[model samples]
Target: MSWLVTGGAGYIGSHVVRAFIEQGITPIVVDDLSSGHREFVPDGVDFVEGQVQDTSLLERTMREHDVEGVMHIAGYKYAGVSVARPLHTYSQNVQGTAAVLEAMQRVGVSRIVFSSSAAVYGTPDVDLVTEDQPTAPESPYGQSKLIGEWLLADQARALELTDGATPLQHVSLRYFNVVGSGTDEVYDTSPHNLFPLVIEALIEGRTPRINGTDYPTPDGTCVRDYVHVADLATSHVAAATAMAEGRELRPVYNLGSGDGLSVREIMDAMQRGTGHTFEPVIGERRPGDPARIVANGDAAARDLDWRMRHSIDDMVTSAWQARTAHPDISE
Candidate 1:
């Protein structure tokens, strides 16, 4: 049986697709290509180009492919942009997730792995965030993700209450800042993400800028948890494997490194990795910029084999190499 991967042509989703294939599981991709690239979907994989909100299309794909599970990753991911486009964000993320669940119910698919975000925590109160941390999402994107998690929980509970219904086995992986490429075939292309912004600036012979430098932290810049996309993909596959094998798993897990790197530190890494020595420009802090937010991943480490297999240098170098490899796409 194959697993349906929504947004499988995107960066992190593409990595998850590759991980599934490496583990001998067939993956069928459904992506709208709004923010994702079609070429990112590996050759030989069955791909359907359509919106996740297309319930009939998803149902047909699930039935045709004999899908056993779903990896729901397609959504409007920009937190700042979501503030200006709340309706569009809700339509794509909240409604999109509902459509996926609806199709799953119709097809008797009982497993799912949700792509959640640490934005659910907003500006976390503590240095180390855990699954138990209070959720106070600050943007439509974050709220939509939290709502998506709720949808999965509610659906699972409803299934448990139904007689003769296959109970839904699901897990939501909350991620922080995801960077690096699992393979040179796909790289981070988000214009809003820090890594890509910096890498793109360097490639275009422009100096990267730091948004906030007066925040309370070493080097006076925002600090955030950064994890390799490949490591994140590994844990996603592990979650899918555990569920398929009837092993118990948590309802949600944070895919994060306990430690964080400051913006200045990241700039230094960019300089070292890319052989560019220009200092970054300091810009006014973006509204709602937090001082720091890192997550404790002990639970994920124990249950999902989550670990920071790549160092900061590894992340920078790989991202640079991958971005440089696709110069035509760089903006």
Candidate 2:
């Protein structure tokens, strides 16, 4: 059976799609090409260039592709932007998710792997945030994601109570700070994350900007767990397989490297990775960003058997390789 990947042409979405293809699954993609690049879409998969909020487009794509499962990853994903423009974030993350669910109900798609975020946890008091952590999102972006997951879980439970052939089964994978270059066919150039931005500053003979230096951390910098994109892709595949093999399970798992690293540590490691030295200038902290954000991956490991292998050095080195080789992101 085929799968549907909303925002399948985006950086993270493209990697997940390629991961599915590697497993011999040709997923049909729905994207508006807003932040997603058309070139990132692999050759075999059907790429429907349209908005996820468009019900007609979603229904048509699902029906035409005979989609069995949906890997939903379409949404605006910038904390600061969401803080600046809450309405836009709500429209894309919340409304877009609702639109996809409506289309699935219309076309009879049974399962979905909703892409949630660690932002939902905001500034948890604990060092590592667990799946059961109380959601207190600081930004509108995080709030939108948390609300979307709630929407999916409630819908699933409501459907399960009814007598139906295939109840809507959904799995929400909340992740943070994804890093790594995708396959040769898929690469991230203009990444908003630190990995690509650091690489960009290195190649340009400029120091990477450190958002804060006064936070209560080892180096007074914000700390975060960076999981490899490939590992995340594998986790998505596992989520799909779990829902398929197991009778019924609607759960949420946090996908992240349990080990936390501070921004200063990351910059230092990156300098070592690329054999380059550049100062990391400390600046005013970006609003809504907490001092530290790390995921508690125990739930995902127990439930999905997911594990992250790539180290920070690997992430830095690989991203540098990609950026240096293809500075223009041409093919």
Instruction: Give the range where candidate 1 is weakest over 10 consecutive residues by summed lDDT.
Output: 284-293
Clashing pairs in 2: none
lDDT string for model 1 (81-156, tens) is 7888999999999999999999999999999999999999998889899999999988888899999999999999
Report how far off residue 268 is in candidate 2 (Å). 0.6
- Per-candidate TM equals 0.97, 0.95
Q: What TM-score should be assigned to candidate 2?
A: 0.95
Q: Top lDDT: which candidate number?
A: 1
After aligning candidate 1 to the native by TM-score, how far in Å is the CA of 191 from where it should be? Answer: 1.1
Candidate lDDT values, in order: 0.93, 0.84
**Each model's RMSD to truth, in Å?**
1.2, 1.8
Q: Worst lDDT window (10 residues) for model 2?
A: 182-191
* lDDT of each residue in 1-331, candidate 2, tens digit only: 7899998998889988888888777788999999998888887678999988898899998998888989999999988767889999999999999998888888888899999999999898998888888999999999999999988987777778867635888999998888877564555654567787787777777888888899988889989988888888888988887887864554788987888999899889988999988888888988778788888888788777688878788877766666676656432
Q: What's each prediction's clash count?
A: 0, 0
